[model samples]
Target: MTKGIQNSETPLFLLSMMMENPEAAELCFPQLLNNSCRKPLPPQSDGMLVYIVLSFISLLTVTLNLLVIISISNFRQLHNPTNLLILSLAVSDFLVGLLLMPAEILHTEACWFFGDHMCALNYVVDFIITSSSVGNMVLISIDRYLAICDPLQYTNKVTLDRTKICVCLCWICSVLYNSLILNNFLRHPDEQNSCYGECVVILNNITGTVDFVFTFISPITVIIFLYARVFVVAVSQARTMRSHIATVALQRSVKVTAKKSEMKAARTLGVVVVVFLICICPYYSPTLVGQDIEDSSSSSPFVVWLLYFNSCLNPVIYAFFYPWFRKSIKLIVTLQILQPDSCNAGIM
Candidate 1:
């Protein structure tokens, strides 16, 4: 009969050996071995400090994402097509920080305290949120491409309805990709071999190579290609605008102003793409060599921690790329500081 929960036999053996066996000569080694073949378990390596740091970072990310979401959503003037994409990204990141990270931290400590159902649900939610986040970044790239390359066409075609449709499609595609993983693959947790964490991979017949290919490699390829094209289009558009202005040779002041504005817009999109690449590369880099890692479960913290960096970055990127968010923050701060006086006036 199936136990319907992860078997910790493997980890127990590993953890036990680590804690039980201690060699002074081996203690001189720089690395801690979570998995060793020694008959006696080695000393228990406490990951409590790591978990506490991760939890703090996760809490900070959640708070920032919430502020971003609320700031964007509450400001009526910021309800444009591009900001819509930003808001979607915020929502996905917020869920990662709020819902996923806590569970992950707990699992890191307790080694999967949740049962099978919870595990499946956690995996599904994680897949959905992560996939959606990647998809949203793609959507943002396309949106910026249109805005920079074909300004007039962007104004005409990038309507609110179209933006909504794009976001909906992003989420749908994300859910579909995750669905593929769950349906074609995924195994019941092994009571002996597995941890009780949510979203723990059922490492069986399927290789990490398969997971890396479908989940990381494919999507990353798409993102890189899209951003490349977007950059090309943006550069071409900027050159075209510059040429047109040079030919017309209107007033010097007007020409300079137009050139500066064009340059500014191009620079904004450039920075956004660059930031996207930087933030996502760390998280996905492991996917390339994930199969080679000696201990997959223990190495997961590298990717998980890198992913947490991504959740925190989106808010900072928005604050940098979009001035509206900064203005909104200033407004919110000023209003909060004045609320008491306004209340007193109203009461009087």
Candidate 2:
């Protein structure tokens, strides 16, 4: 329907053909037709290098996030409502790095070896996790916004039960939104084509645009808006703090330490927001401009590495930017070191 496929010689008709016949493409396309293949494959050396680096980064990121998640979940002190949202986001990112990236690396090695069921499931899982991450980010923004703008009301409104319900709803909505792919377009299978066998349906251009808009563009907009508001609030607080410091400077007896504590909190929160935007924007922005343009764009190793870098940065961000999280990590490390001594004393 779009101008791209208007009169093309090798039209991308596989998606359309699969919609009409459930098992047509798979039955027709040969699995290993030597020399008859239309496109040339990448060199083994370069592809292997990509696989190795991506695999390493992905594994490292997942392990670190898992540790963060475990640390928070295990410790009673880390169970605050705000921290709960952070834990949710970490879990989602970890799953993306752990379960999804390796499978993607494998798919790049050969073809889509997993088949239709696995492919569909893969898409579903990635969709859910990515969506939830975005949703959790938005929720976190709102959480911070409220804490800044309406601390009193926030304490009353943001209860543990409400937070749990909100997370569950976010997951449900994501699943429903992604299920449209399976329900409408992905059902038709073309076994004739080797790659098309596990093909997920691409909706028409209008619907596809809507999907991209909702999934990527809209969330980014919301996050940017929240970030803007948060920045304004932070700037206002800093000015107020400066005014108080000036006033308190005259009072020799009242050495106000609260100003320093407030400034530290603001700095930590600011870093968290900035890092979240930086890491996530690269991954989501490319997916938003549409995948067609992405394919044609000159492949850069830096961009590829940056995509994986998003996952790798979360643990470091938490360790550096969040006071409570840093404290938790230190406590964990200290506990590990001290456990041996405690056991030795017990034996003696």
Candidate 3:
């Protein structure tokens, strides 16, 4: 009602017709056959297979991100700045799985039954989730950079309270920024619809370019630059530790071990950043080639799904690389988390 369907009529009548005569679905809005979008053909075996795969991915995304949220939120020992940033990312990715993924599947394979205003709002939520995810990645990179490059001041510089504040700011900015990007579309939700039942948004060259640079290029450059510096400093510190190990006794050895752990964490998070870039690159290929990102309720299936797949992979990465994550998962899976004073249990 809010977005592009001022003249929508007898939606139930169309539904009843479709129920009575399956062919009635040939027109999504049968009353306006000349203008309504034609329904997609019945699914083939391959189409069914694709649906199965995408549905499974949606389920996995929700489950994995939920576990990550639970693990981070419930465990007192996991309440550090880095983990807090991760918790924020998990919340955004959880919404992606719970809302965006299903919407993608529904719109791509079938008609968009929701009105145009709903379509506009859906894309706004999608942008907020995606942009905040990128923000989280940048924050993670900065956190790693500070930890590895300036270890002595890292705890003071990146405190839990400050990180919580930054996470709140990141989400707030995402909501505001994406709202601006989609403002025109929200005002005229049906501007790009070629026919009834179509839900699409048009991004002109200028707006698309601005969005491309701000959301993609600038953040990526910062991440790569920071991680590069972190890598160089980590290498120097490793050499220093190895060279001084024989000369220094127990006290120095403890410091060296601590530095090594920080460097290891840097390397692990570096892998995550690399994976994110890889999954996301194809999504912006059009923009990289000077094309606008014209999207619909469904959008491009392959690249968009690949982007959503990144959410699923993040938890898997933690499962493999973070011992603490695995341990927490075991505790949760076995229902040990329900025990008295479980939050105080030693996880690290």
TM-score of each: 0.70, 0.71, 0.92
**1-348 per-residue lDDT for model 3 (tens digits):** 443445656768768867887655687767665688888777899999998899999999999999999999999999999889889888988998999899888877888888877888888988999999999999999999888766667778999989988999999999999889889888888878898888788778899998898899999999999999987877777787768645456545544764767777777788888999998888888987887797775467889888988898888898989999999999999999999999988988
Model 3 TM-score is 0.92
Of the candidates shown, which would achieve the greatest lDDT relative to the real structure?
3
Model 3 regions more than 4 Å off = 1-24, 245-258
Please give, for residues 176-279, the per-residue lDDT of candidate 1 as tens digits.
76777665333553333332222345433354456566656776677677667666765664666667644445434443553465445445655655665666
Note the Cα lDDT for every prediction shown: 0.62, 0.60, 0.85
> Is candidate 1 or 3 superior in TM-score?
3
The Cα error of candidate 2 at residue 63, in Å, is: 0.7
Question: What is the descending lDDT order?
Answer: 3, 1, 2
Candidate 2, 1-348: lDDT as tens digits = 100112443335655655666454334233222312222255488777877888888888898788689667766666667778878878887987888677666544444544556665665776677678778878887777666655446668888788888878888888888787445434543222333323333444566566667776788688778768767866766686667645445331222332343334435555655666676566545445555212111234454345446656877777776666666566566775245433222110
RMSD of 3: 2.9
What ranking of all candidate models by TM-score puts the best one first? 3, 2, 1
Q: Provide the lowest-lDDT 10-residue window in model 3.
A: 1-10
Report the error of model 1 at residue 74, Å. Answer: 1.3
Worst 10 residues of 1 by lDDT: 28-37
